[model samples]
Target: MTAVQGFVRQIDLPQIHDPRGDLTFVEGGKHIPFEIRRVYYLYNVPVDAERGGHAHRELEQVVFALSGSFRIKIDDGREKSEYWLRDPRKGLYINRLVWREMDSFSQGAVCMVLASHRYDEGDYYRNYDDFLAAIRVAAE
Candidate 1:
């Protein structure tokens, strides 16, 4: 089992499979580790293009591939790791202050995101250099 860490987490949601069809769901403070405050999705991204080159100050999120597959690369100032969100029942939880970049999206991929906080532009560290400095200051 993949363990949750300060950097990232790979979690499996509850699913009920049947020969006819399947059912899946996610609930705040249940299947998800946080209380969901916002939700959004991303799609129609070019295969060569990447997304999410920033870190949040207090927000946390989980990214899931609802249609196809994609790779999420995350760094915690000192170490980096890559995780694949392939199954529809799976999600990658991004911890606060972790710099993230998503790439290698498959054709027709639809990425769904569940956020722990409401949209706040001031909470974002859009620059990699700024993200690095923020984590450094946070450690002390």
Candidate 2:
């Protein structure tokens, strides 16, 4: 129930446990709040590597750590929070307009992202200052 203005939160997907191994599955618009249009993953990242220092205008995403772990810092202009993604069945859902910074990746960490839209450079606010200014303009 920890939600940042209903724009950021952790979602747990359904998991089936067995003696052999555990199984997890996600369905578009069922497990997540949006229909997944794009799926991508990051791997072989250095332990000191950093990723995702930007915000989206109209796109939302759910990021997961499939192999190891990583930390995500979220900012909504008014508040900031951090989350550690280490579980395969859990993901951090980031709504549109929320700034995000991810780092502190463990060795051999694999990050999977389920996006609501495909890659669009126009939808991204890659600069933190620009993103903050936009947030302020929208608030006023």
Colliding pairs, model 2: none
TM-score of decoy 2: 0.93
Report the C-alpha lDDT of model 1 over 1-140, residue by residue, as the tens digit.
22233458787989998999998999998887789999999999999899999899888898999998999988988898999888999998888888899999999999999998999999999999998888778878
TM-score of 1: 0.93
RMSD of each: 2.7, 2.5
Evaluate residue 25 in candidate 1 and report its C-alpha lDDT on the 0 to 100 scale. Answer: 94
